[model samples]
Target: MEPSNKINFSRRSFLKTSALASGGMLIGFNLFNACKQDVKMPVDLSTLNYNDFNAFIKISPEGKVTIFAPNPEIGQGVKTSMPMLIAEELDVLWDDVYVVQAPLDTENYTRQLAGGSQSLRLAWEPLRQTGATAKQMLVNAAAAKWGVNASECKAKQGVITNANGETLGYGDVVLEAAQLEVPENVTLKKPEDFTIIGQGTANVDIDEIITGKPLFGLDYKEEGMLYASVLRPPAFGQVLDTFDASEAKAMPGVVDVITIGDKAKAYLESEKPNWTAQLSKSKKVVVLAKTTWDAFKGKKAIRATWKEESALESTEFHNEKLNEILEGSKFNTRRKDGDVKKAFAQADKVLERTYEAPFLPHNTLEPMNFFADVNDEKVRLVGPVQTPEDAAKTVAALLGRNIEDITVEMTRMGGGFGRRLYGDFVYEAAEISDKIKKPIKMVSSREDDMTTGVYRPSTKYKIAASIKNGKVTGYHLKEACINGNMYGLIPNFFPAAAIENYQVDTANYKSNITTGAWRAPYTNFLASAEQSFFDELAEELGVDRVQLHMDLLENVKNNPDPKIEYSPDRLQGVLKLVVEKANWGKTAEGTYQGLAVYYCHNTHVAEVADIEMNNGVPTVKKVTCAVDCGIVVNPLGALNQIKGGVLDGIGHAMYSDFVFDNGVPQSNNFNSYQLIRMGQTPKVDVHFVKNNIAPTGLGEPTLPPVGGAVANAIYKATGQRLTKQPYMNNLQAKKVVG
Candidate 1:
């Protein structure tokens, strides 16, 4: 289940602050526009406060609607885009809706996470309901005043008007509406009646973001705040042997050097954590700091050794074991359709392929950071966190504080492709706060953040397909990897891939490398293997890749891929839509190349990548995409996410990945790792399959397909199927790294 509650946001309590968040200005909407109600929807609060405010929104005496955003904004545009969701249903002018961060009350918030592309999709139902419900309540209140049947009154753009056209603004009836019981149900406007749902609303926080507003963890500047940094073992499980802090203490801006070697509990359990977890390990650490830089920079001054576990390296962290296990391992047969072995044997042609993807980092633009002030009595935390409830619980358990004693204020994230969802770093912050007996803000350098990240585990895919008489017959997908006990998590993780004679067999290679959610997680990896493999199989059968996939997808749409608990209609729809948009298999002139698509999250997305090999460097000129996620909370916002996801994937495929030696991570800074720059942004065309389906996630599903598309296009250009990531260097080493 794509449940946001997985992070346990329900466990935390919010400590109310006297500070009023802020006011929002609503933009004008087209009035008198005819609207239809094609899609039935729930009308009421869409999101909850991380605090105990079940009402995600409230209308002030001035008619301003205040929406409490549950998810951290983190450069995902939720800060601006989500509020638009609430406002769309509330039937208020954009100018009149003000947005604020929901306080830390896990029970009140929806999902504080910014991954899975679900922020908008999942929130669509509740947020729209929130606005619609409030609108109904106000309309009723207005009707009671004007003595008209509620049906005779229409609430639009903050005004409740009679059929005769007499009206009162929302502010005029605010008190009565607030006192009235929240409505039991309400009807939403039809798409034709839409005034704001799909409009190109600019980011609500653009001014703040552009003006260097103090809205992020880095902007946190409370007085008496001390900065902290930790020196963790290079790898998890290794124990710190010796520490010499003499030189670190003598450094300028250096206050003190501290050592912590814990055999009982890793890092002191504090009612308040330091909010800076340098690394993920059950092991303890040594601390040094005067300034964050001094603490962070002093790592060079300390001499430490670790007793590495022999099993650390002995337990192979690769898929060679996976190949061994998949061929001989006793796996639960996920699907057995039409005697796949018999079908393969009868086929005129049989193809087998194996693909692998290394571990990936959730390189959020904003490094993970948190500010904490923990004392014996209570602890306060401020940063970007996906699961406040989990963070609070972890802090409480570590610090011996009641859940009520901890307060987590989630800030706008710089960007979180599933990285901030993990609560470990937040736990670390809480620990440091309690340890130092003072409030501390821990800032993770990009180096620390990227290297210490929980990665998308390396994965392997072994596949075979049968092509008979220019027709595809059977398919097999064998997947292997570890993060969760994959052996147990698949009917859930790769349902689509595990269809047909699909077998999901996994072997664990647990390591000190912290692992957490990264966008669509394993699905992205499988998309490359499954989609690309399917593309090749189609070619083998003398068919267009699009036509081939459409055939398979049509078969699986309702046939129910046994390995998948969910049907594949959504995936089929997106695949069809993208192919149509890209004009798949149609000859295109010039140096451009072509590719196909795949799905992730609950959403479906497909893309056709066009590239020109210039000086051996692949110049991605344009990308055409199609997505079907049901409703559009904000079409502009949705499209931007698709565009951004594509670019991110393009950038990673070109120049991002971590390398390590003897357990120490390489590619620490920008020099080692390169981000996509303005010079390389390809033109992206996003086509949405407009429908009334409850929205699904958009942030991640669009990403996975792009990497393979680019690779496929490069294959078309160079005739070499490039399988490895950050293919830029190899291309560039051949003198074409763009």
Candidate 2:
């Protein structure tokens, strides 16, 4: 019951036909590299079968190859780059290949989540194997027909040729190939032979995007789908007391006014597992209508009373609690090396600085929307979800249905930035549809999307550096924030492994405001604080900023530590490359340059931002970034992602922050909050370190360094070192877009 005309292999008849075909290989691979699945895969595969895979390519009778990308594409270019891996190994021309977005099928595609920027890293080998295995099967099919050894035949650009000058297009031999048993051991192509991996390529959907095709979650539609809008509380930790929807229910086109309290309660107390039930337990009243405007109008007309929990407090109260925790000596140590106290006490001078970053909302372009149809037979949901399998599980838990009965199809996300990582929206949509026993499309307005919970946590880092005779002798960092210890904040955040006497202390502040990963997660704010501290330390020691970082990296390189997760060589590699490209030592009039480097998501990135002060307001003119994420799959796509990350980082650091008053967010819409406009965006140049390493993630690694780079550049321009974020606060002047 698919809405689109695209071919789907999950249908029972397609599998039966494929299984009957000769020499066709249906291979299903798991994300064994991530999620702690350390079982070694052997080449021996006498037990291999076509039913064991979730995604595969089939060569039709017309020489067309369609590769399915399992992971969600949140503007990260995964939808195109993943197919490139298959095409490169399959020896097929890019034009001959078509890419398909795979629906969530955990039985076939295990570990199908796109967080941590591990999509490319995890899929690199398995996808290549899928293509290579199919290619080997096709080559064998051609060899059997030619009565020659398989090695003598080669697959090139969807055609198989023999040494005797015999040639057959892959479409001609696919039926024969589908009948043969799949080979266990298939050779993969070397990097030197890659014709498409490193080349610049446009997104596959660019044409559709330019022509205004329906590809995103917001564009989803159906014949009998009803529009829905929910009336949620004004803030987090608030409960709906009562609702009077008489006026709304009597309005034109209004179908129903349903309260979500009973469904939410049943979900939490249901027999199904409640792994994420707490997140999905939000209570709201839904308005179902014939159209989106009717639903929105009905929602606005509804009268509701909300009661704020007594424990939930204001932003000022939370900051006070944060300050109290920072001042308190009781702290949990995450990382520690040499005696930091002795090093600090004996050093010639000790510099201390505290940096703060506020909560940020994921302002996705499309907002949150999902189409769900739930009935006694089955439940089907489709929308822009980063983790479709997880969303299915959540819906299954909520609806008391089998996971297999819940079908969750992923659509192209307008933006993710980790906000879509949660399946609450999907669960919400499913519960409403199941309650109404009809297909419903739940859409979130910009205000609903922004004011809802799950924002980037407001964090503060108190850093102390001990300097003796122009060298950093010791470093201590105490991070005070809500759930700092839980959200992957390790002891060796940055500069910790580089310094000998280093320690990381953390204090957790209690708050009702929800926070989740935004872009690079903790590294985003950490880089802003750590890199700015290094700049301050460089100035205090009378050393160049670029040289100062090099010295620390040299120390880490020469003296390695096991606690350090990043390679000093890689960190140094990007720093050197970016400094050279930015012309660090050289200066131009009307511009000041600042540099910063960070390692995360198995990738190292260095950014140099050039800023110009106009009427005391800083305007970023240009940015040069160098990244080392191993092989660049689709250089053009990678460059676009990097540029987008840079602009995203600058925009968030410059103006994005969620303010709360009595547990309610103040910045509800664009009018209150500012986003980086086209005029304010800087010209960007991106470069990648040439290496033979496997490709890592590019979705978020480039973002962590942009804020620090721009902040350091602003310091150089204004001489005033602004400690707090939204550095524009220091100027107290209006934001000038240039």
Candidate 3:
């Protein structure tokens, strides 16, 4: 069932209601005196009393239920799906619900970040209980009006029906309901009885997004707001030395040029260092102008020189360091089981392979931007930030102001993909506003975003397996990455418990390059490496690849470990389902297929890639994916995420490449960088496992296994092992010579 996207009120009506609500004279009701005899309810629908049911909900006199979505919507459809959980349990019609993005309210919402894909998983129970409690309160109010037991009256679709068949709208009893003591416990609906959840619902902000309305950070503006273009060090390991901004200040529409970072540098050097200092650049040249284009133009006219603080590193340097770390004896043992030495000694064959991937930028469609209005009185920050609370706290600390004096408003993001998780752009906006003591909108060009962005750490993995008498015996996996390793995050994932003689080691070489989470984080590349290695191991063992995975899963299921991070039953469920749906071994002429299954972000996913040769090049034609994320919420949004992750994974593994030459990024724009074009995207068929379990995560789980599936398929098509990422580069180098 598809929920309607049509809104009941017109745009003008919404604006009027918003204007009136902002004035505090309308849509406001005293919770304590809601049932007072002297209190009067307004008649106008625009001015109707909207009693706050809880932090997440507000009910109006007209029965219009407004559900507040606390998490920032980074195109993951949380704005639509999270509210569905509330509406489903509240016994309210989906059409009668209006969703709003809630401000940062620490008193009510916790974990208000958009990264880690834990938004829904963490809020699942609490949000449902919140709705159920409100519904029970309304039922109790209706029962009091009828002089009957609360159990005799039931609420459904905003209406309460008594045993005598008499009905009353929820609005009729909302005042009295507000006066009743909050219920401690309320019954939640069974998954089987859900009418709103498990159904596809259109995005709540789809209209605003498609109509070119102000939704994203780039579209935000305020009165007397100046546009800011900030110039920082052009390369890593470099700091600001000197700059001449006279030419920039003379540019048309240019307002002024200001230097920042002195205060930040001082704060960082103090005895008590602030964590926000690491988020923003320590030195910058800001050009303020009346328009965005003018600001950018003025920034280009500035002449700046940088001083290197350390040796400038390159891709070659990173590769050498990673390889050196992998070969070294000193390493951190993440996980170890039985004696790997004994298992290897008894093995008949020992096979090893090394896989490598380069650093990658998040490349969110919207370049980093934010709006800040900071002053001694209060600070108002508005932008697309995944962590609004963190951003607010950071700004407050930098400005030496009370956190309560700051307010953060979240705007819909064009894309996050873990990029917006860092509020550097937000910090820049706030610092510029505070320095100039004026409101300003900080903007970053595509080049600035690409060159100076938090990137996915480049990593190399060396995996080895021992086979004794045609059976897998021992496994040793070593990971070497930039800045950090995956030792802490996923030590208990698959393959850890499957092999008795399993051991995992990790090492890192801290570079000047900044790195952080990208989409699924470590599992993004680790899954591809592990899955591909398993495929090669299957070949050496003379067994089917699918059977090999099933066998490993059986081992994990039989000998369950207390620290196991994923469910064996759930992983097997997706693998079996995908095998059936993709016709595991069946393929048409000239079509080759490969399969991969992985668990991450508290979800299990299996994907099969179908590859066909197109003019001497193998191209992905279609992908069949099976997911078990527990109960599916908003199948439309779920399908979108599945397809998007698959395509994104394939694109990056096949074509995306980011390189640094002496600490300076070589690709500053799309001309040098490559992304999967429309012609390169494959057809993705998604199937979800039917279950009543609560939802887990959908934003990033489907991405981790896609690269492995594509690589395995390419091996079948071309008889070549693609070990390095940006597979197209390797494929081109190995092209048949005429």
Q: What are the clash counts of all predictions, listed in order?
A: 46, 13, 0
- 235-350, model 2: which lDDT tens digit per residue? 67788888899999999999999977566667666676443333534578999999999999999999999886546577788788788888999898888889999999999999
Q: lDDT of each prediction vs. the true structure?
A: 0.64, 0.79, 0.82
Candidate 3 Cα deviation (angstroms), residue 673 = 0.8
* Model 3: per-residue Cα lDDT over 580-682, one tens digit each: 9998888777888888899999999999999988788989999999999888878999999889999999999999998899999999999989989999999
TM-score of each: 0.85, 0.92, 0.92
Report the Cα lDDT for residue 695, model 1.
69
Model 2, runs deviating above 4 Å = 1-53, 266-282, 732-738
Q: In order, what is each prediction's RMSD in angstroms?
A: 7.2, 6.1, 6.4
Lowest lDDT block of 10, candidate 2: 1-10
